[model samples]
Target: MKDVIVIGAGPSGSYAAYRLSKMGLDVLLLEEHKEVGKPVECTGLVSKRVLDFVKTRSIAGKVYGANIYFPNGKSIHVEKNDETIVLYRDSFDKDVAAMAIGAGADIRINARAISVKENNDSVTVKYRDSGQLKEDNAKVVIGADGINSVVRRDLYRIRQEKVVSTLQYDMAGKIEDERSVNVYLGSKYTHGFFGWAVPGGEIIRVGTGSYRASAYPYMKALSKRFGTNRVLGITGAGIPIKIAKSLFTKRSVLIGDAGGIVKPLSGGGIYTGIFSANLASERVANAIENEDYSQLRHYDKDIRGSIGVELKKDGFIQSIYSKIGDRSFDRIYGLISSEKIIDTINRSGDIDYPSKVIFKVLIRNPALLYSMWK
Candidate 1:
């Protein structure tokens, strides 16, 4: 029996297992995927502030600005002071796995968790290992699995309130522009969400996102709009979003995507996942040592308090964004300074959603502000 069983060996899982193992707890990390960070769903564009939060050096692409396009063919170029890193997600995820291994956590690759059972003080995790199934016991279970987390389904009824399915691809062609990313804020191109152009290696990570049911159609539209005919094959998938508070249960904690730590605005969960895993590991270990596990609710509260306001504000912004007509978008796009746009994408995943800041900007421009309010 281990002290903790961490399901999913991605960013969140690795961080949780690492923290627990460092504290001398027997931590077992399970990963369903054969390896970490393949079929990369992330664009890997994160703010400078993210570097301060995440403790690894796995940067691949660096960006300084972005280009925003309205539905009316009007566009604005924006710049930022902070540098955002666009990493090769595969390398980054593998390195994160290394961190867990360094901390002495027992990692089982290709181990898919089947089910989990919790009885008062202990949790039993049944998983398939090396073509054979096995069951293990642990005092605590942390679900760090990605979007379609089995742990969440098995443990609790996760309310699907704020989830958006995102589709993206790592293309092979050389991007014409690599320094500044591209974003389209029109529902025609991407329904109820937006589309993006992220630079990775020699390919452009182009994709779109929306609510789950609409994701496939929206992604197809984006494919047609982005010159998919000229492009090679595309990669796509549903990105789990945590637009609201997460579900936490007894003797179990859901971290990262499993817990819905994704950015409400950008649908970026990598940074939030790692950060939550770190906190969960530390807090869970502390609880075990002190024999006071009642305050497990703190995990959810702490994450929400640190990131909730921003996420809520961004959610509101995205709501206003996807509804805007072409003409309204043009006026608002004009009101939105290039400086603001650049700064937004660069640091969007790190700090609070700039709602208060947007309010101030709107006050300066009445017509644009009024549109947002509506």
Candidate 2:
């Protein structure tokens, strides 16, 4: 039996396996895909703090100090720090996987998992190794799987609801200014979700999300708006929108999407997944070493204590956009600066509606303070 078996080799799984491997634990990392990060699904727009924590940093593409957009041809511009990075998602994943392997975890690519069985004190996972059936026992199981996690089903017995579906493309484009992240709101702009323009010098990451069920038709609709069909390279995927209360269990714990840690608003899962995986890896390892499952007791509290309030505020933000209509988004983002945006992102992964964060943003842009009430 392995000391830990981390399912899914995404950011979360890789982080967990990496951390535990550094601790000298018998860790096994699993990835069903032939590659670690392919068919790049995420925009990879992350805050500076995250890059600092992982010690895997990225350079800026083009920083926009403020947003430039208008509703009814009325434009508003807000200043920003231009610190956010536009990383190659595939490269980032491969780097993270390398971090784990360097730390001494055994990673298995092309290993697909079908189901998990927990018996007595240990868990056995049934999966297909290339093609044949295979099983592995673990003293502890960390579900680092993505949206469709078998680990989540085996442990939490919870279903993923309210996932955000999206499609994006990387194409040729060079913008003179780089500090602004272009955001568009209102149903007229993006149907079920909103469209984003994260500029990467000559490349652009353009995509939208889905709030309501049965919105598959919206992807094609959005592609036309972004002119992705005309682009040479276009790619997209479904990210499990995690709006759950909490995602930890008795003996088993879910990390990343398996734990439903994606943003309530953006469906950005990489940072949240890595953050949660770090928390879970440390807690779970301590629990195993000390023979104490009690530490897993407040796993939610620890994670929420870190980023919960941000998630709640994001939930509020999403509600406003989903129901309030389009004209509000440009102003909403303009009022919030890059610093405040990072603060919200940093804190939201842990909790819902952080009052302190709201207060800061309100102070910065007093006008929207009323909208917070609205």
Candidate 3:
């Protein structure tokens, strides 16, 4: 029996497995896909903190600022002293997996975990490999299997209040400025959400996410404006904006998207996933050393304490933005276009946690509070 079986070989699972193995625990990491990081769903845009955490280098390009467009063609530009990196997600995932393997964690590809059962002493994970069903016993189970997680389904009911449907296309073209990203905000493009154009080294990734299913038309229009139609690939996925009611039950725990740790505002999960994975690994090690599985509760408490408040604040912000019309968005753009506000954003804006600046900005300009409240 393994000390812990981590389902899903994404950054969260691999990193957790690596950490647990480094602590002299037997760890098994499983990935359903034939290879790790296939059919990339994320836009691959992440902060520098991710690269620093994994202790690896990123060959991807950097984005210095964002051009946020409103429905009336008015825009707000926010530049930052520190830039965000456009990650080559496939390479990033493989690097973390390699570290896990180097730390003595065994990884099995093409292994799809279907069911999980927790007993008094250990948890049994049932998975399918090579068309054959198999089971593995472990003292603890970590579910980093993503938004539609099988482990989470077996353990508890995940009530996702909203799931953003995302569609992205990799088009062959060169953006005018590779150092900045473009964000389209309007009801016409994405109802209750937004669209983005990220510059990859040679190609631009154009995508949109909305609560409504009809988003392709807007994406296609945006693509045409770029003047290139040579499509390389297209991918679709769901982003869960709601946090799960519970993250652990007895011997099993869920991290990453499976636990809905994604940022409610930007729909980014890389940094949060890595952060949660690190905490979960520590809890796993403690539970195993003391031979007491109940110690897993600390994992829940720690994660919630760290990022829970941020998620809740972002959720409220999302709700406010979702209800506003395009004209209201223009008004917001006008308010944020002030030199003082823009300067404040440039100095304090954090993509991973925009709420920090939002509160600060609101406090500085009390008049702007009417725009959000009214």
Error of 1 at 59 (Å): 2.3
Off by over 4 Å in 3: none
Q: How far is candidate 1 from the true structure (C-alpha RMSD, Å)?
A: 2.9
Question: TM-score for all predictions?
Answer: 0.90, 0.85, 0.96
- Which of candidates 1 and 3 is the stronger one according to TM-score? 3
Tell me the spans in candidate 1 whose CA falls farther than 4 Å from its real position.
53-57, 224-233, 243-246, 337-352
Top candidate when judged by lDDT against the true structure: 3
Candidate 3 C-alpha lDDT tens digits along 1-374? 99999999999899999999999999999999999988688788888888767976644789999988889987788898888989888878988999999999999999999999988889999999856899999999999999889888887766656788888888888777788999998876786889899999888888888875766776777667677657788987998887788888899888888888888888899899998899999988998999988888989899889888798899888888777787677777778889999999899889888899988888887766677556
The residue-by-residue lDDT of candidate 2 on 1-374, one tens digit each, is 88888898888899899999999999988899999987567888776556755666444363434343434434444443435566767878888899999999999999998888777777788888888899999878888888888988777777887677676666566443566677555554455566677777667666667676433455455456545445656666666765456566656688888877877766777788888888888898898899777677667787777765566667666665566444455456555535655465344322223345555556666887554345
lDDT of 3: 0.86
Candidate 2's TM-score: 0.85
Scored by TM-score, the top model is: 3
> Ten residues in a row with the worst lDDT in model 3?
221-230
Model 1 earns a TM-score of 0.90
